[model samples]
Target: MKFHNKKKKSSRGRAKWHALMTIIAVLMVVGTGCSVGFGQNSRKNWEKNIAQETVQVEGLEGEYTLLFLTDTHVVIKDSEVSAQEAEDQESRYPMFVNAEGVPAEEQFPEWIQYANEKKVDAVLLGGDIIDSPSEANLQWLKEQLEALDMPYLYINGNHDWTYPWEYMTDMGRERYLPLLEPFMQGNTAFQRLNLGGLVILGIDDSTNQVDAQALDRYREALMDNRPVIVMAHVPFMTQSALSKAVEAWNSPVVIGAGNFGGIYPNEESEKFISLTTAADSPVELVLAGHVHFYDRDVIEGEKNVPQVVGAAGYQGNAVLIHITGTEN
Candidate 1:
């Protein structure tokens, strides 16, 4: 559970040289371009362009502050993510980058400082704690979280369990999850937290399948009298792919060419939709990430329950929720 700042070791060490050579031999492309695939903006620009909205909900005794951070994708080696022999992986993103000032990557720590200074009740790490599931990267994450004063609820995004150069499968996760567990505060995949008289369900679904376990967990989390907040890395199927909304996105290309945005659909997805929209469903709000954008929507069928999907804040921005009239 120890975190360390990376020592300023020489870059020309034989070990570093060998690793660099291996990366070059594997992909044959040197991806260290000045371009940030996920382009960014200055804090000043975010302040001018970003607008914070407040929403009210039912069932609470005191105010609760929840900060949501998404798509951090901490690149451990400073090369393009996953050392993927390329740098333009972010070029296809749909966001209108204000690529003139400080990149979001450099501003991430300030977001943490803001949260701590505000003394938020808890922090929700939406997904992608690291761009690659490297031991070094996870250690880096552990170091970062050590300074926070509130609880951290989290889940894994596509980038979390993948190696720097390959796809992530359940098989890959079996080996990766153990290494990541000790560095995080709560369940990185599936777990429930009761704080401030609110039941928060954190579902970790890497694959698209809406499995029975997730639905069952969702159902059980609603058993309490307190309002419930459901969180996940990817969102549940609720709408068609975004077109105009695409401008707010950061990784549309990795998601798909035309497929700018939308949750994965399946049989389990129906059950999830039906239950969340049901009159008896205790969910008060749904918080999700992965699109690397800021958005808020009201559920079409559930009394217009609010759902706020956060941007990949680790790359740039974050959303904070203030709930009053709730007690833990």
Candidate 2:
């Protein structure tokens, strides 16, 4: 695939661009007004906030860099939403702000700008790209992503489909698939992107569960013998990551470790976990976010694959992943 700076011409013309910019500016101003005293020192300068990690892939031919972002809970309401619903969405803005008090909707554009400037091979949006499935949020997300200079893969997060007042359930998630399908590329459950010797698998474990079809697709990917990197909304269980999550949230908020407190995985999710962390598993890295803090640890299989849990994107947290091939 081509990895170059190519600006996507807007079909909506300059009016749309100006309108989007106006909205973003208003959000930044509102965010600054609320937390200006506390976050004054933390504004702008996206490069300084990036956390870097590297992994070695045995069969890979060359080095690849990916900008991984997650949990950017942006809320943009349009006319379709009720006034009460809009107010509810606005109430959630403060939770996702950074130290500088900039909301996710504002910080997201900067993150995308950084990615374009750096020109990474691909961008992996692990999930929670928006606060809900509102028409405005979906439209804004599509515009920003389509404008990217590099390729990107997006999967659903629990928050992406659910409204501010609703509980996250399978029915709620399925209710919005039609709205989210444009971003899913082909399959809503799983999607794969090939970058030379590397294979990136994006799974919709937004609800902390995986179905049989996703498991089957994962199994098929393993058969190809390519070095794999899995990205999802909820993280898998590991000793260090799990402990940190429990301490932070007072519950086990990860996948495959619900025995500690959170929802237990179903049979298919269990099988998926088993395959990913198996002794002979080809998965070299796992990327996820949901607990809203950065944690890195080794999943305890015989191989001990590295897992990196990115912090919340709204707080200006991002991971710059460098994948180097072992084979010269």
Best by lDDT: 2
Which residue segments of model 2 deviate by more than 4 Å? 1-48
Write down the TM-score of every candidate.
0.70, 0.83
Question: Can you list the residue pairs that collide in candidate 1?
Answer: 60-325, 60-326, 61-325, 61-326, 62-325, 62-326, 82-164, 292-312, 293-311
Candidate 2, 180: how far from true, in Å? 1.0
Clashing pairs in 2: none
User: CA lDDT of 227 in candidate 1?
Assistant: 80
lDDT of 1: 0.62
Candidate 1's TM-score = 0.70
Give me the runs in candidate 1 sitting further than 4 Å from their true place.
1-51, 78-105, 183-187, 238-241, 244-264, 326-328
- Highest TM-score, which number? 2
